[model samples]
Target chain A: MPIDIDISHVARLARLALDDDQLELYRRQLGVILEHAARVQALDTEGVEPTGHPLGFTNAFRDDEVRPSLDREVVLAEAPEERDGYFVVPPALEGP
Target chain B: MSLADLTITEAARGLRERRFSSRELVDAVLERAAQTEAELHAYLTLDHEGARRAADQADEELASGTDRGPLHGIPIALKDNLCTSGVETTCASQILAGYHPPYDATAVRRLREAGAVPVGKTNLDEFAMGSSTENSAYGPTRNPWDPDRVPGGSSGGSAAAVAAGSALGALGSDTGGSIRQPASLCGLVGVKPTYGLVSRYGLVAFASSLDQIGPLARTVEDAIAILEAIAGHDPADATSWAGEVPDFRAELGRGVEGLRIGTVTELSGDGYEPAVSEAVASMVAELEARGARVEEVSLPTFDVALSAYYLIAPAEASANLARFDGVRYGLRVPGATTEEMMARTRAEGFGPEVIRRILLGTYALSAGYYDAFYGQAHRVRTLIARDFARAYERVDVLVSPTSPTVAFPIGERTEDPLAMYLSDICTIPSNLAGHPAISIPIGLDDAGLPIGFQVMAPALAEPLLFRVAAEVERIAGFDARPTGVAP
Candidate 1:
């Protein structure tokens, strides 16, 4: 099976910025990989259920209780951009 | 024997008998690590001062007659993907270049509780994505047997460190044969326990459903000792198993007599190197000679397992790696808007392979193609697991060559992603089925590189995997050591 996926569109969804060269390279490589993976589509999986988890585990619940978390200072220290006691980020929207 | 050459089991015994102190052992390993650093490039961070302090404390406790079991005072290496408190944990990617984890992974915490001292964090592929460690931003870890060849990755650094005697044993994660393949190429015993057997609390996620933490050691017994120290329930990880952890060491001496071993007809075939196939065949003959029944079995879906893995793993990876945005932790590139900042940060931080996987995964799980790609792959995964279940009814364990060939040249498979993916064909099925598997060195190939024999058993049957692996170790008697290493 031949695939003609939009490389730029996929990168947009993935939030990765790819230049023209990388987009071309990925387009070709993903084509080959998807072609190989297309082998599974030929099998008749009519009644077979999808295995999202191998161990068949379902939603795991625990006692509803608050627990001690990582120290605020330690957790915030790893942030790339931090303000006083909070993570700093770029504006959610550009100024009009 | 020199302290560097001692296995974890032997080192523990020697420490208890007063033949050597933990400080002496750690110093010996650190000295060897320094000697090999220029050539092997196996470590990302060497915690020399911390290791020495831990060793001094261990010696004090031992001198006071407080023994802390088998792993006490043993020095080991961790694959950089496992979090270490206040220590730099880069998954060999520039994306996480300066990130220092504030807490230890549950597995690392368990090792510390067992009184094991971590000497360093080893290298791996960027985000544990590639087959060869060449994808590492720091540099590739060269194979100890031949420096020109790849050590097999993304757990390459841990395997190379163990083979070179830089550390007594090490921890590595197997998403899709990362641990087993490197162990095969570098001449060591690598075990991937049943899914959920070991907690994934702090293992930097690669593929949540398929990823598992296991040990790589110079001997099966050492691997068993390391696995015992790390396996059990953890409320920190919801998927962690709640079953009782067994004493794997006690099952080591159980012979293979009357055990039914199945050889996968699909895996033992033409594409493999003659050395790899021959080694596996010879191991099978040895098992049969020891009164185990050997039979040929076929899992027709075997070939598709790799294809399904490529789809499923990458899809999950796309979701797991979403946390690496510029805001929370890791590298950040400034931009005018938040969206632009995220895109620039990811583009600059991630390597090409990681980007490629994210692209592929994103495409697979995207709106229009979800059912045709990710959904089909999940169904294929189900078929593959059922095939294993069907085959296990007639056989107690399944055997195969751990890898198709020995270590290839460093840059050989980097160009073609599919070719590198094929290197893991033999080991991927067990991961997909969520069973326990092990790779033990069978013998060296014609070029003097090692070939590995893989033994796989049912889920949570790690004791059986260890028992069979020990028998293979005895029969093969693989004692060859790499050249140009310290004694």
Candidate 2:
């Protein structure tokens, strides 16, 4: 069965800005890939539990203790923009 | 012999015998890297000053009788995705331009502790997303065996560096054949150890569950040395196995005698190149003659592995890459709002392949499609693991062609994303199963390009895996070197 995907909507969800050319290209390409991936739908996976990790190790707990971490100055130095030792970014809400 | 061409085992021996100083070995490799840079494009950032300083320290330690281990004083390359402190560790993506890591990845730190001199960071697909290094923002790494062909990638640069004698051995992360496929293409040994055997603390995650950092080397023993130096539990990575890491080097001479080797019935014949299938057949024949029992085992679930991988890996990638939303530690594109800034930054920073996968992943994990795509893929993953478990009950190890085909022409599959994805068909199953696998060069093709025979073992079977690989390495006696690149 062929699947219908809204490439633009998906790109929005992925936080990507795709131009017209890239959008068309990815639509065609991803269509083919997902079509092939449709084979997974045919497998009798009923009653088989999903595997999130190959090793199947769960709840990798450790002692909750403070450990030395990367220095603030060093970590902030790699940021694109920083002020007051914190990363700077555009506002989350629209301006008044 | 040029010191650059020595395997880690041989190089370590030379250092101990005082045949060459660490400085001399580093200089020889640095010079070779310079000679091959224009043709191979193997390295993205060469740590000349750092490598020299490390070499001098190694020499001083040796002079004072402080031995660090097998990797001490050896020069090697790292796939750029593995973080190195103070070095611009780009995952061959523009997004990470000018970004220097604050700390060394666990594997890199372990290598440093072992006294291994890191010559440089090798190129790879952006975020280790593609099968070929062509997806790198830098440039594709050419195969040393045939310059017109690609060095099979995301680990292409590391494979080429080792093959060209620019580095004795290198570390490459294998999410889905990133290490093994390239090693096959470049005529080297590549190991993708059991999933948790090596910590993922600092590896740029493609699919956290599937990714593993392993060694690509000229010889099996050299690969063992690197694997041992890097393997062990790390508290920093919670998923890291807490079990003991065995002495992999001790398993080298055990041979494959009395080993049960099963050739996966579904992995060969159809899409595989004739030479590749023949090489695997010949390897099984040699092992059988040497007293190993060979049989055919069917893992029918492997047929859907590629499809399952395409979905599951991308779904994980979409989540892992959300951390790269600009404003912190990488390139940031300006926009009116934060979300807009992220969109613009990702649009400009990522390459075509990365963008495509991100979109695919988002779609797979989207509200309605989750159960059909991502959920079903995980179920398939479960089946694939079950198949491996069942097969291991019958066989001590499994054999297959490392790749369906050899290193292809640089531009041949670039246009077809699906075609590029197909390149990793044979090597993806082991990743999905979370089993340990190794690819060793068995012979050359009719065109003189190398063919690889892969042997996969159950989880934590490194010792057994190395034993079979060593026996095959001895039996095949594949000593042919690439003469095309003038190494």
Candidate 3:
């Protein structure tokens, strides 16, 4: 399958503020990656089950038990911003 | 006082003999870490004070005749993704730059219970995203062998810390050869235990099913020692295995006599540097001479292993990383709307490689592409797994070159990501098969860089894995000393 990737798509998806030079550089690099990924797409896996892990371990579960929390003051000690001991969320709207 | 060169078992023995106080050892390692942290950039944090308290407490308990097994009072490090209560657990990304968990990762709790002192967290690829430490938000961990070269990653920091003698051992996460490849490049002994061997309860997700936490050390015994401390079923992780965790060190000294060794016929083929191939051949010869029968075997599906890996790894990563979107715990971006906030935060928080993977993985699993991409890849994974199972039936262990080549320059393959991804070619199948694999430094290339010997076994076959790796380490004379330390 062909990819319609140019530097702009990469820049937008990657959220990088790339200049023209970086765009070209990243364009070529991303192309190599996609091309290689294309090669991986060519294998024949007709009847095989997709193996996510080699060994299978079913999810281990623990009953939800409320535990004592870390010292709120100590927990918030590293916070860049806090309000009433809860992590302060960013204002929902951008400033006008 | 040079605990840097001592295996974890040896260090514990000395501590037990009261030869050196745990505080003294911790101080030594902490000092080396402080001195080299800037140059090597191996650590994300240095808990010199916290580690000292743990060591002093260990000494008090030891003097009272208590032993915490191998890791007790041993100073170690971890890739920051392994959460520890009261310690900053950044996953090497700006997204969680200062995130500290209220609970310890299951592995960390086990290590602490074993009397291990966590000196600090090591750096890694952002969310364990890249093949090089260069993707770490803090800074790249430099190769101790060649400062100009990178410590192979996504577990690069753990490998770097061990290689530079910064810590006695470290815990690293492996999904897609993270532990083994970095260990190979950094010349440390690293083992990614069979999928559920060690609990992954506190490890930040990369690819949930594929991610595993394991030990990285200077010697096979050290890796085994740490493994003993952490391998067990944990109620917190549903996937934790039910079997008994074997005493890895106990399986050593058998010398691989009469052992059935399978050599991957294709891995030793082309695409490897001549030096790496020679090292594999020389090491294989040593195994054969040591009374072991080594024969060539094939995993025809192996050729397609990497292809399946790319599709599967990223596809899972895309789903796993979705939880990081400006949530309650991590850094949040303020935008006019939630949609804008999501994009801004992910863009600002994730590194370039991370974004690329999220998109690639997301694309693969997205509508209209699932079958051709993820679905097809999942089926390939089954073939690869079956190939391993069949190969294991014929051979006790499978041996291969851990990596295709030795450590390259810092930015040599970053510009060409595919070239970099191909480095994990030999190691990825083990991950796909969810098998136990170990990498020990075999020899070096002409450039004096390390070449790793990889030994993999059927599921939960750590006993077999340790046996072969230790024998190879013994005959190959692959010591843990830093390259120039012989002087």
The better candidate by DockQ, 1 or 3, is 1
lDDT per residue as tens, model 3, B1-487? 3666667778889998888988988887877776677778889988877999999999999999898787888989888999988788889999897787878999999899989999999999899977778888887888888888888999999998888777889999999889999999988899999988899888999988789999999888888888888999886777888778776766778888899898898797678989999999988988899888988999888887787788788878777777776645677777666556666787778877887777677666666768887888778778888888888788899898999888878889876667778888888888888888999898878788999999999887788788888889889897645663211
TM-scores vs. true structure, each candidate: 0.99, 0.99, 0.92
- Badly placed stretches (over 4 Å) of model 1 are B484-487
Q: Largest DockQ belongs to which candidate? A: 2
Docking class of 3: acceptable
Q: Tens-digit lDDT track for model 1 on B1-487? A: 5699898988999999999999999999998898898899999999999999999999999999888888899999999999999889999998899889999999999999999999999999998887779999998999989999999998999999999989999999999999999999999999999999999999999999999999999899889889989999999999999878776866778889999999999897777999999889988998999999999999999989998999999999999999888998899999888888999999999998999899889999999999998999999999999999999999999999999999999899999999999999999998898889999999998899999999999998888888899999999888888873444
Residue-level error in angstroms, candidate 3, position B250 = 5.0
Runs in model 3 deviating more than 4 A are: A5-31, A57-96, B484-487
True contacts kept of 1: 0.85
Q: Quote the lDDT for B306 in model 2.
A: 97
Residues A1-96, candidate 2, lDDT per residue (tens digit)?
A: 556778889999999988888888898889999999989999998899999768889878878899988899999999889999889999989968
Clashing residue pairs in candidate 1 (N, C-alpha, C atoms within 3 angstroms): none
What is candidate 2's lDDT per residue for B1-487, written digit by digit as tens?
A: 6898888888899999999999999999999988888999999999999999999999999999999999999998999999999999889999998889999999999999999999999999899988879999988889999999999998999999999999999999999999999999999999999989999888988899899999999999999889988999999888899988877866778787888999999998778888888888988998999899999999999999999999999999999999998978799999989999999999999998998899899999999999999999999999999999999999999999999998899999999988999999999999998999999998898898999989999998888999999999999888777776875
Cα error, residue A95 of model 1, in Å, equals 2.9
- Model 3 TM-score is 0.92
**Candidate with the larger TM-score of 2 and 3:** 2
lDDT of 3 at A79: 58
Candidate 3: deviation at residue B358, Å? 0.6
